[model samples]
Target: MSLIKLSNIHKRYGKGTNVFEALKGVSLDIEAGEFVALMGPSGSGKSTIANILGCLDSPSSGVYDFCGVNVSELNIKQKALLRRHYIGFIFQGFNLLPRTTALENVELPLLYRQVPKKERLRISMEALELVGLDKWCNHSSNELSGGQQQRVAIARAIASKPLFLLADEPTGNLDTKRSVEIMEILQNLNKDSKITILMVTHESDMAKYASREIVFLDGKKKSDTKEDS
Candidate 1:
């Protein structure tokens, strides 16, 4: 089964005369270990699809399947559980806690999961090492550079070993060099660890790092293409 399947999905906001349709009959499937990029300008429905895939919002109509389960039909609590257990989210902003060590910040999610301290430490450390941030684990967010801070954010996202990573404009706030570095880390994670990744970005340059590109325009999929492996 596909890791994620969206069949004719739609999303509308507001009501009646003020209704704004964000996604119109959108359909897509992401198999396991695929690195897919969702790209478009603002209001093009790329972020709308990402929000739906991340379980942050429900589709107005149609179905969403993840790992063969119907996510559109799940309750709020169930959706929250799905996000907590299966999705690792990375945003443009480095959401790391200020004044906290990188290791501690990475362990925050596991704390919410009630994992034992020992195991949490181990997993967080492994995630940091994956991003080549092990040596900086003791540094505070303020002590790190923009790229280092973003690396910590990625480590935090992967600490739980989530089924997939959802990255929303992850390189938006960095310089060109740092942006490429971050993309390389994501590409490596997808290539080496077989981590499924769905990223949303308007930057064509960053999107190239993903194996597949899915472009959106006017709430519809404009193109879906895969590069040679």
Candidate 2:
């Protein structure tokens, strides 16, 4: 069974004369343990698809099934619960609190889930270690470099051991070298941990890291191809 399935999905903003369609009958299926990349020009609905995949937004019409559940039928609270338990997100901005330590930043998700303090600490540390940031756990967000900050962000996302990760231009703010490093870490996580990943990136080089690439144009899927390993 597919981990994610979207059938003839559509998204619209406003109504009538003011209406704008962001997704036009977009459909896709992603299997578990696959690393997929979404690529497109600005306003191509790549971000719209990403948001829908992450449960940040629902499709305006059509079916969206996630792990066999009809996500389109879920209520707001149900969607929130699903995201909290099964979905992890990484953003381009690194989104960490300035004064907070890396360990604390990673623990924030667990706190929301009501995990015990000791267990949260343990799991957060493990996540940090996975991203090779264990030594920087005590360092504040401001003290870290761009790469380190992104690692912390990745650590935070994986702290809950989510079923899948949704990364939105995660390396957009990094230099070529740092971006490559981040991609390597993500690749390793997919290979070694069998974690599913859906990443959005404008850079073709960055997209090359994924096992499959899906391109969008004018709110429509243009191509979907598997990369040669």
Candidate 3:
């Protein structure tokens, strides 16, 4: 099933005198459980596309159908609901709460869903275990290593069991070895849990791990490659 459909999407910033077209008439389709990578240089609309997928921003003009629902005209509250219910986000910066333990950080999102305390803890611990962070559950974000912090972030992202995972430059801050480890974890989630994964990255090697790769240039898609590997 197609989980996301974008038709003639347009995203612009500023007004007449200082206008900038971040995304120019880009259209794409992503199917459920498919792993995709969006790659491009800076100013190539990569981040803009991620924002649109994450519901952090909307396009200026276009049809955005997410899981069969048209979201182009959704109000802030509606968008927020969708974001909380269906979307999981991973970023270059780990974004864990500074003073919170790994378990608390992972449980935070489930708490928003009103999950009971006991169930929430169980689910959060499972998520952390999936990321190989169960042993560090009680450690604060600041106490964890970079790779561990990102794992905590991933645990938090998956705690809600979101249908889609949208990541922007998720490995940009890590060393090559750590980056590969994180990518392996993400690939495992996509393969084992069947979670749809879409990531925006500038690294070709990283994009190669995805099932499909879409390259953008000058605010438009320049090439799209699908690998069987």
Candidate 1 runs further than 4 Å off: none
What would the TM-score be for candidate 2 when compared with the true structure? 0.98
- Candidate 1 on 4-111: residue-level lDDT in tens? 999999999999999999999999999999999999889999999999999999999999999999998899999999999999999999998999999999999999
Off by over 4 Å in 2: none
Q: Give candidate 3's root-mean-square deviation (CA, Å).
A: 0.9
Better of 1 and 3 by lDDT: 1
Pairs of residues clashing in candidate 3: none
Model 2, CA-based lDDT = 0.96
**Model 1 lDDT, full chain set:** 0.95
User: What local lDDT score does residue 127 receive in model 1, on the 0 to 100 scale?
Assistant: 95
Model 3: per-residue Cα lDDT at residue 166: 91
Pairs clashing within candidate 1: none
- What TM-score would candidate 3 get against the native? 0.98
Q: All models: lDDT? A: 0.95, 0.96, 0.94
Candidate 3 lDDT over 73-137, as tens digits, reads 89999999999999999989999899999999999999999999999999999999999999999
**lDDT at 39 for candidate 1?**
94
Best by lDDT: 2
Candidate 2, clashing residue pairs? none
Q: After superposition, how far is residue 119 of candidate 2 from its true place, in Å?
A: 1.1
